[model samples]
Target: KVALQFEEDWKERVYDRRYVALAHGELPKSQGTVSSYLKDDSHYVTHSSQEDNGGKFAVTHYKKLKSGNGYSLVELQLETGRKNQIRVHLQDLGCPVVGDLKYGDGSDPIGRLGLHAYKLCFKHPVTGEDLKFTSDIPKAFSAVVEAI
Candidate 1:
């Protein structure tokens, strides 16, 4: 027999999301934060410069883990989730994620988006205990990091 349980208000719980991205060019700093008001603009999201416009505030912190062969491995923590926040913010920093043609340099070395969600942390809904999950980086990502 098996049972499943969930918190009464689990949908409102907060979570931490971390991802690794292979980006083009070197980041300006080893680590930093990107904050912006993002709004949906058709196929993608864009920074909203106007205060009166409707947009969601997004923030992310990124660190350079490795760089070589015209590519840099960036580790990112999402403070606020907005559509395409990582891709847009990275592009704003002038280092788009490799293989992210819509929001990057348009190079598809691995034939897929160069972004991977490596970690997620949150409170367990039913038990109210801290829960953290991590996934191994895909071989493609590791290969790019090693190659560069």
Candidate 2:
């Protein structure tokens, strides 16, 4: 496995992150933002309920990429990286990532979590050079997305 390194100044740079997820259904809008307070109250799940109290702020912007057969492919950009932020926020929207049994309806169409980091960009800590990385979405994900 490849380990990702983060610098102390990472928060100062725009870390553009993107992921591909299979949602249970279509979202209310093609593109929108989800913001909430998230707390890790359980080892198996994250809580987004306001009553959880004094949780960390988290935000994610998502866009619907494709939809068919009771599922939709969504691209997400996270503004904060709180633990389980995406899963919790998406679940709050009532469309958790497919195969994410911890947060969603527990449907495993592809036999694994339908979440993948597709791209990441940020400034290099030492070189001060702009760096970017992109990864092709898994074939299983692409197949489902294109089938729509």
Candidate 3:
């Protein structure tokens, strides 16, 4: 599907990729493309070999404001819409989004995907009005403001 739409190899254009779960559960560690991830700077599937990696998921153009353990901001258009596409994809590669249940540290007390539908800069679906709006980032994404 990606090749048909983008008309490109797509793989070479992959600046980063991963697999993440968007549902709640513990996944087997022996899954996903871990080898490629270790050698490729542009890939991160998840943390460690075992951890949950899902919950409201979204794929954004991830932008890390700092090195590992700092702040991160991923901005991405909705690719394959799914309850957990972002989380699932990230988990597939192996860096589930933070705070995710099916795809993050099980310690996450937060019950939502850190992802948000912020900054919708487009015309109104009706009324033909030009508009741009942004959804307030959930307080939970606090880890973001200081870095991005």
Model 1 steric clash pairs: 68-148
Candidate models: Cα lDDT each: 0.81, 0.80, 0.40
Task: Indicate the worst ten consecutive residues by lDDT in candidate 1.
Answer: 1-10
Highest-scoring model, TM-score: 2
Model 3, stretches more than 4 Å misplaced? Answer: 1-61, 66-71, 109-112, 138-148
What order do you get sorting by TM-score, best first? Answer: 2, 1, 3
lDDT of 2 at 71: 79
What are the per-residue Cα lDDT tens digits for candidate 3 across 1-148? 6336333433323233322223222233323222111111134433322232332233333333222233233443443234445554555544456666556555343466655666544333334355555665565555443434
What TM-score, over all chains together, does every model reach? 0.84, 0.87, 0.43
**TM-score of predicted structure 2:** 0.87
Q: Is candidate 1 or candidate 3 better by TM-score?
A: 1
lDDT for each residue of candidate 1 in 1-148, tens digit (9 for 90 to 100): 1123345444345477799998888899999998888887775647544253578888889999988777788999988877799998899888899898678879877889999999987776657688889998778876776782
RMSD, one per candidate, in order:
3.3, 3.2, 12.4
Q: Residues 1-148, candidate 2, lDDT per residue (tens digit)?
A: 1123445556766469888888887788899998888777657467886553678888899999887777778889988888888888778888888898788999788889999998988877656688899998777865765674
Query: What's the CA error at residue 33 for candidate 1, in Å?
Result: 0.4
